[model samples]
Target: MAGERVSLDDALSNVDVLDDLPLSDQQPMVEAQSCSVVYTANFDTNFEDRNAYVTGIAKYMEEAATHAELNKLLEEGEQHAVMLYTWRCCSRAIPQPKSNEQPNRVEIYEKTVKVLSEEVKKLTKFMKFQHKAIEVFCNQVKRLCHQEKRKDFVSEAYLLTLGKFINMFAVLDELKNMKSSVKNDYSTYRRAAQFLKVLSDTQSLQESQNLSMFLATQNKVRDSLKEKLQTIGAHEELLCEVVNISVHMFENKMYLTPKEKQMLVKVMGFGLFLIDSDGCNINKLDQKKKIRIDKIDKIFKNLEVVPLFGDMQIAPFNYIKRSKNFDAKLWPLCSASTISPQASLMCHLPRIREEHIKYISDLARYSNEVITTYKETARTDAENRDISDLAQRGLMLLSDWTSVVTEVYSWKLLHPTDHHANKTCPIDAEEYERATRYNYSPDEKFGLIEVIAMIKGLQVLMARMEIVFLDSIRKNIYQELQDFVQLTLRDPLRKAVKNKKELLRSILVSVRETSADWIKGYEPSEDPALKGKKDPDQGGFEIKVRRRNVGSEELELSLYVPPGPSSTQLYMVRTMLESLISDKSGGKKTLRKEMDGQHLVLIDEFHKTSFIWSYLLNFSGRHAPCPCNFPNWHGHVRRTTCLYPNRHGHVRRTTCDVPRACTLTGTGMCDVPRTCTLTGTGMCDVPRTCTLTGMGTCDVPRTCTLTGTGMCDVPVPVP
Candidate 1:
């Protein structure tokens, strides 16, 4: 997963920042991530003004071509479909109520129906507009293609006709998705609310028996929707299949294949005659007397499953990126048979191609640089910075080209909805001042072509930066982890030796499996060395075993006596002096201490015979951080001095001011300095907290848990 390309899902997951957010914040976090710039890129509907208008036109025309001379008929179809769906769903949610169920189920259902119907009316208006636009666009194409050179114009005319179907496919797909997914459309709130009302308290709801009945009701209402959807899905699938064929024909040199080459030659010649020229060859009129522009629609209707477009051999794409242009040579299958007046406009079509490409690329580059500057503050480490700016800056188009892109994509431009009344850019109010300085004028920076370029640039930049960020992050993580591995790996014999008595007083070890001699060392309570004497006689000695490290093994010597601080030195002393044995069987370790709250712990169990220089002097030369995080952990392991003068002078030796304190571990007890007001207790792990004095020993479990809700969710013992 770390090595694989970051998908939209992964990027969004990180935006949610799963680990940092509380469970309660999960839903909102997900919503926020979806609302972020990355998610907005996936939503193609948010087009600029010019593009949206164009797309709107394209959409309505396609809907028109589907019907004959219908103004509101297609829209009515959309309304009927949505209304039936809404009513059925609400009606099912409130089953007959059995005469004893919820009192106002019917009233609630009826109100829901009314609300849903009201919403459908508004939604249908967009659909109706979309239908009209589609029809108008087709009509425009029909008029544009009436050509004197019909054969030459056929390809250009066919491309636009082809786009009509593509646009329809895109619009309808978006509509279907919004209708089904609640995550996409918040307008589905009513239906979601009804669902929640019935399935409320999912964790402990009492309607377990009625679950199946509820499901059945949902199925009953959704059955019609499902059928309508399946039909649409089939059509979309076919539409996509056709679009893929068109794209291949347009892009990959449609005449490369011998058969396709023959088709293009014939189509061009036939198109020229059908436009405005009188027919020279009678053979061109095979199916009809005249090759007509409207006949192009018939080709789509009965498109043969000829293996010409699909499932054919193709050239490798390796050099395609470096190639100068998209091989635009193509056989216009739509115009393969006919030409008309509409085909005549190809000669008039402006050669604004390069201008459009440049506009898109330039806008993409600038946007990426902007997003990059914003992100750099968050990416603090210079070592972490690399070739992760946005994607390849897209080409810059002219204002006109930008407008075209926006219009074609059906996105709203950065302009007011009523562009005719007020020629103003509808930039976010907060950024208006900055935008003006950035050369984004209030009026001129819009329309179909320009808006399209901006959107195209935005999408390219969004995907590009995301790719770059993830790629750089992957490399950074790999290097850091490798360096960590290299640190210990450089030395074959050296291993990390952590002293436990200084940290928590308990030890752990991992060693290799093949070594005969145990290489075990412990922190000296006093002496610097003696290779950490292992006296077999002293019961401190336990079994020896082998452990593994970096695939190598060394014998590990562990002293494990039965549970009772068998892990501590006190247990060893008890084992030696059988006479002092008292059954405090399995009692939790407690560190009882008293202090004026000024003295610090040095070390315990100093094996040195010298008392004065045993601990304090040993650590005198070490560096102490200005604000040492570990107050209890003295810097050095050899020396420990807890000056509890009130008790005994020996340190690491438990001293109890409570009359009788065991001189275990041969260490000093708690120190009572100049003031006799301080009471001193022995040091241990689970020592009870003193309520009156507010002081405790720093042994056993060392962490101080903060009380109350804001603290970590570390589980507490029930007792």
Candidate 2:
């Protein structure tokens, strides 16, 4: 009654809709609403309580009221109320505690990778277990690795490391090829690794970064990486390239230390010593893994990069020398081995023999070319240049051949000089040195000064034996014999002569005379013994001088004469030899210059009595010394000199004083030297006896022994 009245604006909008229904029609609507709630207890209604908690019918209006806030507070309020009502219905009005859980992908991934690594380790070690275990483990990890990011990391780590395990085991043969199902192995690991890299690139560990989506796969993918690795058949050839490419890397100040460089010497040099080429040479072995392991062992001699194992002591040379192990195992693959006196020299050398042979042949050809170029270049002078300045180009040719010489020297070291002589064995230092001079032993020095001292002694020997231990130097002075020397020393070289033995006699470098490079300036106070000092003189040369006015330079080149097993002093002995040679050839004489000066220390085609001083010189680049074609090495030298004693404790030459020189067939005179005391046996016809004093002797006693001790305390043989 007080406010039935409406404002004019509302009255116009409602049109006082009550106007039509108000008096008569509205009477039942108003009367029913007023009486409805009077029986609420009987109606069993919770609507009022629910409405008290919920928002109004006009949600937008309520939202508008709280528009200043960012969150939709009204909607949230309604949701909370609805949740409370539902909780009350289902949970009997008991309040539930809020969960404190969050997604933990980090722990999930780490655990998966760890488990996978452990499993793969077991596989590598050949541990037997249900293959199902690995499968189940992977499945469990991937299932929980629900997040795309986690699956990628786990799969990648599993595949790559596991693949490495497979390769290693394949080498060791712990796991044979099997019939196990790999529908998941290939698809899960290999593909996961491939894809995970992409994912890691796109998204990093930062929490702000978005994770890539991951899709579960039921299909398997085939990986062919190993196939590609296997397709590389010419392994030795490729490795040679690797060596050639990496050689300068170490040589060009790139090595951090000296030991690294030293290690390379063994690695590269040893490889060349054994065979001609690098890979599938292992197929020539009992097992391919052994060669790889051997190579790995060589690499570790440098102390860089973690090694899988330690120093392996093997009787490496036995197999190469005579074991026949490799040939038996790899005969089908054409694998064979050669040996030398030095142990461990040819062990595991060339990976592929055939390939290596071809490589060496190529190197040898290049070396020959260099030798030819040197000949062409050295003869042409600038003023009288022959064929487009050949002389100007000769020095370059010489350097090239020198390299070839070094390569050939390496090969000779692998294959030592063969025995053509039947000389008596030489006495060791303990036997000979103690009796003559102070006792000494060989030892390597560590300091650079000491090392340089070693070089000095070697240089002296090189100077004395210019034609023997020749340096790889090209000069127009020795042009006549240069090409011959190179041809002898190239990779595929001729036979190694007992040059060092003869060299020792010529330079006077006996076991007793050497000490810390002292030989360079050494002058023997007492002359070296010859034939037990019976002669009191080994050999001597008369020196001569030659003065030739070459282009008005007044050049003087001296020459010296050769004295077999003589001359106590080696200092400048080479010069003495040359001085004697020039005078013998009837050259000009100079008074002031000593006749002992030598321009060249050695020469071939020497007089017959001088065969002890001659050595054929040939050179090359690869470590394969082929046989020499000696123009003067007639069959007579072999037949006649078979009884002559060489420096290596064996008889080398049978011809004495032009015995075979006069005629190709030797007069079959048995003039072999008697090394033992006479015992009235048919073994020797020469009259000799054994005694310690001054090479003197007594009649052969019934009880006397020839020992290294030079005593006759016991009988060596019954008389």
Candidate 3:
């Protein structure tokens, strides 16, 4: 019995020594004694359902010291363990023919035996390597327990190494099942072959020589591998002891409370379980499980749990921190952790505003460049690709800018009260206005107002870009370019222009109303009865002005007066519109040419409104009233006459067609004679124009004009 292996039945009969031991000790002894039964258990049983047999054994080896030589041995041991497990898996995948069934050809049996021989040779080498590796690993574990520093022993790296050891058991178990399958298949084939008498004496001799030798070698390798795995299982208690000692060491060093130490152990155990159960590559794991592993990994790496080792306490918004020297220019590029202080955001409003302005300006310029290069021309494949890339970059930049602005806005919202005084929270518009007025002196509320307007305009542009990209799939680059110019560029510019017009009108009315008291002082003395009465002129002027101003300001400041916030906003709006329109590539001219009749009318109206605003702002009795002139679509100068109330308060309206050479006199009268040209039937033959007239009437005969008596008229045939 010296060289004989102990059978499972014989081992069971010899369990008397475990009988006197405690139940806990008896249990592991019984499991170890029944290792063969566990190894041959049905595959349906969970592999991870093992008891703490190893942990119990590892307890007694906690004080063993490791030698320097064991380090190299342990490393080589882990490598061999991995190779051995891989070979065992490969060996299991080799097909075994059924022994009870006769093969259609003798070639099948010969091939199976040949493959078995080759595998046996390879497995023998791996088994030798693994045998040495296991010895070294066990010795290392013993020495590791006696070492003072056990922190590295409990690291993820070493835990992974231990996981390879546990995997060896599963490999051996699977190999046993595979061996059983091979035996059953071969037995069936042998019986059928013998019954059929399918081989000659010489063939039978050759088959026995090759097949029997291979079977013997395979059984030897498998037995050796199983014994090696059992050796590891026998040291399971020592491994657990090492882990326990290391955890205690870590607990003291980390200053963890008893509960915290327990939590750490539990987390470490979970991580080790995952490493043991699943292979090393976490990317191949199920999504939810992978996410859990990642979170736990962060917890371990950063030690982000409560009661950290030092005096560091978690900040309220610790997820994002602001740097002391936060730069607004670099804000868009800064990491989330360095760009979130409310005070920093408030302090950098001006620079941030400038950055946004510059971005919009650049986007506009780039858009024009895109149009000039790609529009109205056929493009090669490379050109088209380039265009697409540029467009995508523009969209990406826009998205980043929008996100940064939104984040800044969110921070503002979170800390709505001003930090200086800690006042009650204000609405977004009010807060923006107050910040602007305080930070940007002289310009008052306009600085922030312009920024908000630009943000809105950019938002509109972003929306248009989205549409352009979506449509670009079905449409050519040219069509998309046209769409960009029309919707993204021109549309926002039109809105800004309209807004400026309204703002200008409001400022003019406000200034007039505020200076009404001054106007009243210049008026002649009224009779005692009419002293308390309101002036008819005042009512008319106020009514006419009120009809012109439209829309409410988003931020209404009490201190907002003429030429302050309103004028600044108007100037800003005008500047942005001009920058977009002044493309060096003649895109502005091209845009005008492609515009529809409505857009042309808007341009005309804008110019006319600008003229009226300028005239009113500089109006004085010393200067004579002159007609406002602006170029028409044909590049011809068209004059519009202005009429002022005379001393007697008389006013008149008239129609006239003055030549280009005509001029208006100091009395608000046209100095040139008006000529009418008519085709045969005497119709006016031209579109009639309207002009304001003074108190006097034209004495020239057959000329249409306004008079105090009535209106001058020339009869003509109806169309």
Candidate 4:
């Protein structure tokens, strides 16, 4: 029995684990065991009865051996049996069909990906349902291990497999929780999207028909509101004007009056009310709010709703004004008043207008400081430098300015200039050609043109400002005169002067003369009387120099000249203009050399000159000779004496000059000539001897053939 136990131990120890073997090799071992069972069952065979006896014995012995081995495994080391069974049942890879084909890399890759994809697709579901299966398996293993028949079972492989199953169950529970959270998020998001879609489909007014209907409804409502406001008397009449005034006053640190407040309440319509400083309701209106203008005025006039505190403190601008002793800031706490729970707190909050005003002023001050620094820097850099140096400095300034502007533009507060939009100059062909003659980078050229346009716009703005200032002054003076006539002196004649038709012309004339004189010093380079071909009502300057050929169409040149402070810059600009006017390309090039790199600057400084030319042009007639080419405007001398037409209707003749400079015989008068239908006789009245002398100097000879009698001073002729 000891030897047999030793032999059994050795055989069991010699038994090899086939866990890692391929199914092809493993299947043969199982077949061998079955074949041994068949051989043992068939040990006794009686030919005919052998088959039946073998089958019955083989089935009984196979069942008995399996049961007995299982019992032994459980009593000894059930963990090893469980591990081996679990590996075969659950963890083993699926077996491929038996074939002699070698593994293809492509097919292997495809198969591996397919398997992995399937596993990933079901991983979430697997993790969810796997915990229960793992738990059951662990419990069964524990039961087997703790069983009275197999309590001592211990296998390292089985222990390791059990631990892995336990760990997998724990990880699967955590995974299940994660999947549940993800599902919950997805569901919530879907529900929210569904709600939003439903709401938008039902309530959105962006559809064309809906938008039109809404707009029509809004118009009707606005009309009704305006009619209601109009029926409200003085409040209605002053509402629009007062709203603007109040807002302006508000910006300037002034509080709104009752009228202004009432107007705002009516116009703004909702989400507003008047309140006292103490968190108390001075007045409240329904959500469909309206206030009687008279009531507002009365409330302020009567000085209602005073608090307990006195006037030792300065009241906030947003707070209601109170009587002297009740104007204190702490009055809200001391006073007993009706409180509101639902009112907007902002409506009752005191606004320190002075504080806001100070803040705005500070911003303005800072902006002005920056502007001053820029101006100073630009001016200083430009001073004492040649054109090239100035241009380099200006380039630096432009770089800085561009950076600053880029930042400002990025803020999206204002639209930037579209350099490509309508990128062409409105000038004559020659002028356009001249402007484009200088080669420059596209960016530089565009910038130069845009800056020139901006400079023009700036000048226009300044001119407008000047005109407004002048108009204001005139109006003020006129008002003063009317006041003097109506109020102070009470002179009826002067009052008549205001309304009388006859005096109207004189008054206008006086006003015009006064205005002219007032702005004389501030006048630009042009005379206002002849400012441009454009009408006075148009209110801008334009200059054009045209040359008219006698039989051809007129050629034109538009000019834009900007003004500058520097004399040298101004001189260079003047030189360029003179050259342009004289049609001398050489002169232009000379000036260009002198003002190198300062083309933009020089051109901008000619605004005043252009304005002057435009002004002078306005006084001239359409048929007038072009100023650019005065006498030889048509490329030739049109006249020898007078540039314009004279009284004689000839270009050369004046009123005093006669057509004939000399009569017959070429003297001032026809003395020696004899031609007379009036005399009724034709004769050579001169002496024959004097005729002998052929000299026609005085029609007399110094020494002649006929008479040499000291040579008669008068001419002698013979016929």
Best by lDDT: 3
Pairing residues by index, what is the TM-score of model 1?
0.20
Lowest lDDT 10-mer window, candidate 1? 506-515
**Model 3: residues with Cα > 4 Å off, grouped in runs:** 1-107, 143-241, 245-719
Q: What would the per-residue lDDT of candidate 2 be over residues 126-239, giving only the tens digit for each residue?
A: 222212222332343333234432212121112222222222222121112221221222223323333334225433322112111100211110012222323333423333
TM-score of each: 0.20, 0.16, 0.19, 0.14
Candidate 1, residue 265: the lDDT equals 25
Task: Kindly list the per-residue Cα lDDT of model 3 for residues 1-719, writing each as its tens digit.
Answer: 79999989889878966776666321111011111221211211111212212221121112111222333454554453443333312222324344646564456555435444444444444445545655655555544444342322232224334433433332332343334433443443444345445444986657644544443354343344334434332233334433333354343333112222323433343223322211232222324342233333333323222211111112211211222222233222222333334223345456656766666775576466645665433233344334444444433333333323333333333333443443332333344323322222323223333433444555455434433332232123223222322222333333434445443233222322222222234322342111323335543212111101122441242122222112222222222222222221122242333434465465444423332222122222101111110011111122333232333445434443332332222222222223333222211213222222322332222333333233334322222
Candidate 3 weakest ten by summed lDDT: 621-630
Each model's RMSD to truth, in Å? 41.4, 50.3, 47.0, 58.2
lDDT of 4 by residue, 580-670 (tens): 2221232213222332234324333432223222111111111111111111111111222212222333433222111221224242322
lDDT of 3: 0.34
Please identify which of the two predictions, 2 or 3, would achieve the higher lDDT against the true structure. 3
Q: Model 1: runs farther than 4 Å from truth?
A: 1-106, 145-167, 170-719
lDDT of 3 at 144: 46
Better of 1 and 2 by TM-score: 1
